[model samples]
Target: MIEANGFSLIGIYGGTFDPVHYGHLRVAEELVEVLQLDHLRFLPAHHPRLRNAPVVASHHRVAMLRQAIHGNVRFSMDERELKRPGETYSVESLRELRQAYGEHETLALCFILGADAFVKLPDWYCWRELFELCHLVVVNRPGHALLSDPSCLPLALRNICQERWAAHADALKKISSGLVYVAPTTLLNISSTRIRTLMASGKSARYLLPERVLDYINMHNFYAGGK
Candidate 1:
């Protein structure tokens, strides 16, 4: 873990990553630098609570992710959600991390997510407890607007986050959990859905994702024939 201000910061980036693409990588990379994260864990969900199961198999998805983040020391995969049975819940994984670190460790967990996801916070399982478990780093997506306007958030979430907003990213280092920080990252147009569509139609998806991951997908013929 990277030490800063007497604390270790670890970023937990959770997503389906059906086929890891440049969009996901660029955002994570920016967050790592913005948050001064020691390392960021890509927590791929086996079965997300709010969305349908991934189109690709768990093993294949995991393999692609490994290749996609191969040389990035600040990025690594966390197989906890993939190995856990049943639908994946953010609360459970964060709890496990906290327990593993113990109550006395000088560690900070930052949950990196997009603005779109943050607005739907109440729909998540044990959403409020998330604040007690880790700080939230909400990044602006291509189409989503900033949360600066209180009206942008649902009434419930807005009220809960009213006092949780941090003035800046550095505030996360001062507190272990229970703070919200909005980050501005490069808005890469790449998306996994578009890449999958191209692959299914026997079209080229080069440059949208890493060559290593694209090569793996081609070798296995994944997402083709409608998967």
Candidate 2:
């Protein structure tokens, strides 16, 4: 069970983590520092709804995440989604986390998502209810546009847009009544897709991922496409 008192910032960094690269780690680190997060949970997806197929197995993804975040006291891993069967939904994960952490913990649960994912929040399962559960921290990603189109957001979300983007933290806190936030970070060109492609072509994936993670990937013969 999770516990928190006062204003606790817990960041949920959910992803496939195909092989857990540096870009992913960097984003988490930056969010933790910028938001002064109390703790950051790295949730690996067992089955992502948007992805046609996962590039790597859950066990491997989890292991890679562990390796990537090793020695970081502020970071931890949660296999809740991986333990569940079928499609992995953010709403479900947040619900379970809320139950574990209690409702009146004065807690702030922030979801770390890329720009592309942020743009598609309206299509997520029970997306409206998600705002009532936790805040969203949208990170800048290469090749994705800002979420400026109101039509792309649900009615519930659009209603809280002012508070979500308010310049003042208190204003953000007031509207947060279980609201969502959009934190745009520096854009990094790195991506798992590009890493996989490079690995498949017999090229080096160095600098794309953490050294330990890359070793694990090579040891497991991952992304040697057409193998």
Candidate 3:
């Protein structure tokens, strides 16, 4: 285990964020509180590799995200993935972050992810090298099962999960290379898929999305029966 030097924690929250909603915002908020993070960056992927491309245009998606996260001082947007060519991968972004922040012995660069995403870590690009760059803070989300036993997971995933699992945020604070902490976050049962479908059906996605984001979507008439 690498030594923890009581470093400043910078949380990374990345997603396609087809539309930023309370599900995304609330999770980030609780994580900042639970981890006592110094800052949290909301990264929107331009071209995600594992999933279908977002229906909304890149500029519009970024605009909605910016409006959604507007007044929060600690929350900020990182457009590295958005600006990069080719499909966006988490490891690429993390590598850039490591290069930028690795010099500080007293800095913990953490990447926050959902349990659904974390379970599929084996399929991600340079996933093994991921631990070397930053610690993973996995937040539990609805509709995903958390495998309690390591043996039940894939060989690579089982090995990593068993070896790096951390019981507390302090455990992550004390190390650099390998630490995975599972966080119990607020269960907001909202998804971009559902949001899109609802809007396409001409239904108001009022509380599921932020007022500003809803307004943007309405103004653009996006997802209006798009198949």
Best by lDDT: 1
Which is superior by lDDT, 2 or 3?
A: 3
Q: How many backbone clashes does candidate 2 have?
A: 1
C-alpha positional error of residue 118 in candidate 3 after TM-score superposition, expressed in Å: 1.1
Residue 187 displacement in candidate 2 (angstroms): 1.6
TM-score, one value per model: 0.94, 0.87, 0.94
Sorted by lDDT, highest first, which candidate order results?
A: 1, 3, 2
Alpha carbon lDDT of each predicted model: 0.88, 0.77, 0.85
Clashing pairs in 1: none
For residues 28-64, could you state the per-residue lDDT of candidate 1 as single tens digits? 9989898889889999989988988899988889999
Off by over 4 Å in 3: 1-5, 225-227
Residue 146, candidate 1: how far off, in angstroms?
2.4
- Supply every candidate's count of residue pairs whose N, Cα or C atoms clash at under 3 angstroms: 0, 1, 2
Model 2: pairs clashing at backbone N, Cα or C within 3 Å:
176-179
lDDT tens digits, residue span 41-81, model 3? 99899988888989988889999999999999999999999
Ten-residue segment with the worst summed lDDT in candidate 1?
Answer: 1-10
Q: In model 3, state the lDDT of residue 99.
A: 89
